[model samples]
Each structure stands twice: as C-alpha cells, then as structure tokens.
Target: MVTLTPLEAELLAVAGSVPDPELPVLTLQELGVLRAVHVRDTDSVEVELTPTYTGCPAVEAMSTDIERALRDHGVREVTVRTVLIPAWSTDDISAEGRRKLREFGIAPPRAQRTAGPVGITLGPTRTAGQDPEPVRCPNCGSADTELLSRFSSTACKALRRCLDCREPFDHFKEL
Candidate 1:
C-alpha cells in the first residue's frame, strides 16, 4: 500500500474540502477537480487541479479558494496548478457529484458510447452511423426530454425541457 506523509495528508484533507465556486453543492473532490496534492521539500504544498472545461471561468476562483483553504490550515506556501494535457471529461464528475447535480435540477452527462480511435461526432446533423443518446430529466427521472438550446448557462451544459414533467433544466453535456 502507498504511504502518505503528514503534510501531504493534511494538504489533501484541506484542499479536497474546498468547494467548487460554480457548484457549491459539491466539494472539489466530488467534482474530481482536486487531482493531486504534493508536499514539497521546501515546506510548501503543490496542488494539481483540472477544470471541468477549458474556458471555465470558475477555475480562478477555485484556485483562490484552494489556496485560502491551505493557508487557513496553517500551510505557509501553496501553489495551484491547472493541467489540461489529459483534459477533463464529464466522466470525471464523481458518482456523488452526479447525485448532487441531479438533486440540483441538472441532468448529469450520459455514459459515452464506445468508439474507435477517431471518436464519435456530435453536431446538429448526426453522422450517418452515429446514434444520439437520450437525455434524461433530472427532476422526474424521465427519458422524455427535448433539447431547448445547444448552450445553457455554461458551455458545458445544454438547456433541455422534460416533456413528461414540463420542467426545464440543464443537462451536463458529455465531453
């Protein structure tokens, strides 16, 4: 089993508890944004964060919150780094995060379909061989939903209306 130093463990505990500025209902750990925490030999903490999307404006706020959290926990030095090499996907959202999203009236992203090296295409016009998955309604747990708009309050979500419940909600779009 892997072992953690006292400082590393403390840093993780503090940083993981930091809540996402955009979605306050979930912690950074729940959103899978708090990727890793390291205790450097210089007696500083290094945190790795992955944004839900490339252009997410809340990343800065998140970083600030993380730093503040560490500082409050008696950590003198802290560094927050954003990593995009592997990129962040809707799948990164934890199961608890999904439950929170649904409870907040936002439909979570659907499971991605298996594809080859090229990956699946998404647009107004579906590829001849690609079949779009149905978007479920978070409010009533119904599959009878229709797209209202391609974009919602954020780029990562789409506006959708549930025909069964006649409720409009945001659908966390699959990355």
Candidate 2:
C-alpha cells in the first residue's frame, strides 16, 4: 500500500470535513459530491466533484469550501474541478447522508423500479383504486400529502404540502 505524506493525509481528511453548503448537516463526502482527491508535489491538492444537479447554485459555495479546507490543511495550491459526465444520482447518496436528510425532515430517495431493463414500459392500465402510494408527510408522517410543485428550493427536490398537517416540505425527488 502506498502511504500518503503528512500533507496529503491532511488534505484528504480536511477535504472530507467540508460540509455541503445547502445541507450543512452533511459533509461533502456524505453527499457523494467529493469524488476524488489528489495531492502532487507535496504542495498542490486537486479535488474533483459533481454537482447534485445541473447548474446548482451550491456549486460555487462547494468550490469555495473546498479551497478553504485545503488551505487550512496546508495545501499551498488547491484546484477544485467539477465533472459532469455520468452526472449524479440519488444512488450515490451515502447511508449516513440519507439519515441526515431524514432527520432534516426531507424524505430520502426510494429504490428505483423499472418496467424493463434499459427502458420503462407503461402498462396499459393502472386501476383507479391502485394508485401509487402517497408520500408520507415529512412534518406529520401522514400519507396524505399532495405535490405542490415539481421543483422546489433545489432541483433534486419537489415541493409538497401535507393535507393533514397543512405544512409544506421538500421531498427529495426520486431520480
């Protein structure tokens, strides 16, 4: 096994310490945004990440946090790079991250289901009485919420209103 120098080790540890700007309770690593960390020449550190969604405003804040963390960890030069290919999916969310989201009153993503591999087939009919299960209210835990909007404060979530509690909450959209 290759041993990282003190500087490299420090960089890695500090980089993981940086929290997600939007969801402050969870660190970047927990959000699965901190993809890779590399240190070269003992002074420069490069970190790669992908945004939760396209054109997410939090990207700037994430980059700033990364730079700050590396600087504090003794990296004289830091480079924050974002990669878009392959994009991001809810499946990338860590187990700890889901717990944090749930504690924050946001439902985490559910397991993916498809009609078939490589494609989703629409059945000829979904009986009127067989509607998909309603999302549980984040505030009241009642399964009587209605989707208010497809988009919310973030692209990855939807705005929903609980019919039972009359409270609005963000539901992490299933990707």
Candidate 3:
C-alpha cells in the first residue's frame, strides 16, 4: 500500500477541501472529483482529478482552486492532472456527499440498475421482475415528484418539481 508523508497528507486535506465552483456547498472530495494527491518531492505536489462530464466547464476552475489551496497551505509547487480513464460515475460520490446534497435542496442520484442495450423495442419486453422507482422530493421528503426538464441549472442535474410542495428542485442525474 502507498503511504503518505505528513506534508502529503496535509496537502491532500487542503486540496480536498476546495469546493466546486458550481456547487459551492460540495467540496471536490465530496463530489469524488479529487482523486489523489501526492508529494512529488520536498517542494512539489501533484493532484489527480476527474471531471463529472467530458466537457464540464468547472474542470478548469476546480484545478485552479486546488492549486491555490495547496499553495496557500505552503506547497510551493502544485500540479493538477485530470484523468478520464475509469471515467467518473455517480457511484463515486460518497455517502456524506449524498446526505449533503439532500440537505442542500437537491436530490441525489438514484441507485444504479444494470440493464442490457436500450433501443426501440418491437413490443413491451418485460424483464422477470423489475419496477420503476420514484424520485423523492428533497424539500418535503415526498416520493411524489415529476421531472420538469432533463437539464437543470447544471448539465449533470435535472429539473424536477415536487407535487406535494410545488417546489422545483434539482436532481443529480445518474450516469
């Protein structure tokens, strides 16, 4: 297993604490975008990050924020690298992140379901036993909600309306 030096650990802490520009309430680590931080040498540090989407506009801002955070923490040299292999997924988001998202008036992504290729079917092909799940309202804790739009304030989220509260909220879409 890889071990971190004291400086590396501290650097990681600072880098992880940097918040995402779009979702100010969530840190990069909470969003699972901050992948790894390593102390390259006595004075340089390297950080690995993954974007939520391929053309996400926040990636550059996140990288700048991470570098600034590390430098502020006394790391003279910092490098932020974006890795796309093993692409990021909603599953990468931590439990704490989900909780925070719920508390912040946003519904987290639904649990993942495995399925084969999706396309136009000739007729209703029924799987042995599977049912559609409802999206819950973040504000009222009600499962009665309807999708307003596939896209929300951000590309990663969808606009939804709570039938009970009549409040529009964002739902973090599942990949």
Candidate 4:
C-alpha cells in the first residue's frame, strides 16, 4: 500500500466523508469511489475518484462535492480527477456500506460472478439456459424476487420486488 502523508490522510478523510448524490445513505468512501488524496502543497490537493460505471452522470456531482468538502476543510486548490483504468466494482463496497444500503431499503450489490458451473434451469424464459445469480430481498431476506425493470431511480440500480414481502426495492446492480 502507498503511504499517505499526514495532510493527505486528513484530506482523504474529508473527501471520503462526502455523501453520494444518488444514494445519500452511502458516503463516497463507502461507495468505494474515492480512491486517493495527493497533497500537492499545504493548500493544494488532488483526489482520485472512480465511478460506478462508465458514462455515469454522478461523477460530475461527486467531483463537485469532493471539491466543496476539501475547500471547507481549508483546502484552496482542490482537483478531483476521474480515474477509470481500474474499473469500479460492486465488490469494492465496504461491509458497512452494504449494511447501510439494506437498512435504507436498497439491496446491496453482490460479489463478482464466477465463470464456472453457473446454476442452470430449464425454462421457457430467455435466461432459462443458466440461472443468473439470485438477488435477495433486503426487506425480507428472501431470494424469491423478480426484476421489475432493468433500470431504477438510478442507472446503477435495478428495480425489483420481493415475492415474500411484496415490497418494491432498488438493487444496487453488480458491475
């Protein structure tokens, strides 16, 4: 791991504390978007951020928020850079972030899907050949759910309903 200077660490804490625009329940750090903080000088700093996916509009808002946060913390020259070389994944989310998402009535994203031996079902549906990973309901803890829409309030989330609780929720889709 790269060692952060004392000021960089402090500034990172401030930048990471900014709440996500789409999911207010999660902070930028919790969302795993705030990557690093580079202290250029006492008053200048640079931040690295990754988006949930390519073409996500939230990156602009996130950058603005990060700049504002750093400014409030006595930073004068703040630059929030968007980095996509290492794509953001749902697995980057912290355990606390997942729990918070569930508490906020949104199902947290699952881990990366494995390539070998996927569960398959013989059915008439388009996905009948191989069953996609089950997305459990955050409200009822039941895997019996159906996708209502490919997109929800946010592009990163999908709309779903729990078969047991009958409550609709947004699932933070895996990247």
Candidate 5:
C-alpha cells in the first residue's frame, strides 16, 4: 500500500479549493479543469488540467492559484500540467457546478443531443436554420430576455438583460 503524508493530503485538499478565475462560482474540479493530482516521492505536487476553453487567458491565473494553494499547504515544488486531448465541454461541468452557476446569477448551459459539435445539436430540423433563442435568466427564471452584448465580462459568456425582472445578467453562451 502506498503511504500519503498528512501534508501531501492536506495539499491535495487545498488545491481543489482554488476557483476558476473567470467563473468564481466553480472550482477547477467543478469546471472539469482539474484532471488529476499526485504527490511525488520528492514531496513535489503534480496537478493536471484541461483548459475550459482553448486559448483561455485565465489559464495563467489558474496555474498561479494552484501553485499558491500547494505552497500554502507546505508543498515546496509544484508542477501544473495542461492537457488538451479530449477537450473540455459544458457537459463536463458537474451538476453541483450547474447549481453553483445558477446561484452566482449566470445561467448554466442548456443540455441537448450529443450528435454534432460541442454546443451544436442536429435535430430533425437543422440548427443552422434557426436563430438561437435567448438564454433564460438564472436569477428570475424568465425566458423574456435580450442579448445586450455578445461578449460579457468574459469571452465564454454573454451579457443579457431580462425583461420581466429588468435585471442584467451573464449567460454562458453556447459555443
């Protein structure tokens, strides 16, 4: 049996607490960014991640957060590895992550058939032919919404305003 030191275990726990810089409601794990963690024989910590979006600028901050969290837990050496294969998706977000996003006032992604592109789904009708509907407001659960901007505070989301509640909110746009 492999033995794990208390410090190593503690480091692992703290590493998971680091939240996504863009989506603060979700942790790296909940965002499905954290792929794995291992405590090396040399007492160094290894962290693997798949970026939520390719060319995401938040990755640098995420790596820094991981290193800081591990360092605080007494890990002197830390390696943050980025993996790209089997790309990350909104589907990868956990159920709890969806809940967290809702609580944070950002609508979670809508679920659809897994037939086509990452966010596209082909039904009997072609998705390309229809204009995408407005995403519901997470705060008030209203479908009466309008897109204020294609890009929100982050590139992954869009700025939307609800007609019923008259609230401006961010919606995680379908890719």
Candidate 6:
C-alpha cells in the first residue's frame, strides 16, 4: 500500500464519487471498485479500477466516467487502468452500499465467510439451504423469499419474490 498525497486522495475521492453505470444509486467508492488513485505528476494522474467481475460490460463506462470526472477537476491527463488480480467479491460492498441497495428495492448480499468456498446453488430458491437460510425481501423485510431467477436485471443479482409481500426484488449475489 502506498501513501497518497493530499491531492491524490482528493482526486481519488472525486473519481470514486462517480456513480456506477449499471447501479446508479451506488457510487464506485461504495461499490469498492475504485481501487486507487496515483498522481504521476502535476496535472497527470493514473487511477486503478477493479471490475465487479471479469469481462464486466460496464468496465468501459466506468473508466470513461472516471476519466471525465478527473478531467473536470482540472486533470490534464487521466489514465484509468483495470486491475483484476485480486478478484472482487460481494464482501467488497461497503455497509453504506448495502444499505443503499436495500433502500433501492434490492436485497444486499449476506456477509460471506472467508474460510471456505461459497456454494450457493439455485433450486426452488436461490440459496442452497445455506447458513443464511432466507435471502429476505427488501420491500417488506420478509424472510420467506423464493428465487425467481438465477439472474436478475444484472448478472450480479438474483431475482426473488417475497412470499409475504409478493414483491419481486433483486438480491445482490454473494460472489
């Protein structure tokens, strides 16, 4: 981990503030994809961005947004690099991001244990009788939710319908 200069930190915040192209409600910072920002020299900077997953279609849009944001902040040259060495997980989502997801009619992913491989298979329900039994419905706070589809509006999410409220919502999958 390298120590960032004050300007670099400020620029990072600016770049991170850009909203996700797919999930507009959450910023890249909250999504934990905006990995780092480095100042190469005065008016020139490089940003490290990690995608939510490999081959993510939104990576280009995210990079473009970050570039525009940095340029708007008076950066003469901005380079956004995609890094995937340390793969992103649902655990990367911040608490604030989870809250925002829930508030936005989506169920946030349950915290994943780091010790073992996560095996969530789709059956009648999305969760395969995992420790976290019910995925829960974001609309009515019901634990009797059933999986509607393995893929939701986005590949990162699963579709579920609440038995209690009969409301369908997306659940950010634990990856």
What's the C-alpha lDDT at position 70 in model 3?
Answer: 83
Tell me the deviation in Å of residue 43 in model 5.
Answer: 0.3
- The better-scoring model by lDDT among 3 and 5 is 3
TM-score of each: 0.85, 0.80, 0.86, 0.87, 0.78, 0.92
- Model 2 score (lDDT): 0.76
List clashing residue pairs in candidate 6: none
Q: Candidate 1 on 16-120: residue-level lDDT in tens?
A: 888878778889988887777888855688998998888899999999999999989888888999998577777778899999999998888866654323264
lDDT of 5 by residue, 15-132 (tens): 7789988778788777777767778756688888788778789999999999998888777899999998777777777889889998999988766547347643443221122446
Error (Å) of candidate 2 at residue 123 is 12
Query: What are the per-residue Cα lDDT tens digits for candidate 6 across 1-175?
Result: 8898899889989998999999999999999998889899888999999988786899999999999999999999999999986778889899999999999999999887773467855445534344355687889887877887778788899888888788889999888
Task: Give me the displacement of residue 14 in model 4, in angstroms.
Answer: 0.6
Model 6 weakest 10-residue run by lDDT:
122-131
Prediction RMSDs, each to the true structure: 3.6, 4.2, 4.2, 3.7, 4.8, 2.1
Q: Which stretches of candidate 3 lie over 4 Å from their true place?
A: 114-132
Preferred candidate (TM-score higher): 1 or 6: 6
Model 3 error, position 15 (Å) = 0.4
Q: Where is model 2 poorest over a 10-residue stretch in terms of lDDT?
A: 120-129
Q: How much lDDT does each candidate structure score? A: 0.80, 0.76, 0.82, 0.84, 0.77, 0.87
Better of 3 and 4 by lDDT: 4
| lDDT score for residue 162 of model 1 | 81
| Per-residue lDDT of model 4, residues 1-175, tens digit only | 7998887888888999999998889999899998899988879998999988788998999999999988998999999899986777888899999999999989888776653332434543222223465777889888778778768988889898887888998999777
| RMSD (Cα, Å) of model 5 | 4.8
List runs of model 5 lying over 4 Å from the truth: 1-12, 119-134
Worst 10 residues of 5 by lDDT: 120-129
List residue ranges in candidate 4 displaced over 4 A: 113-133
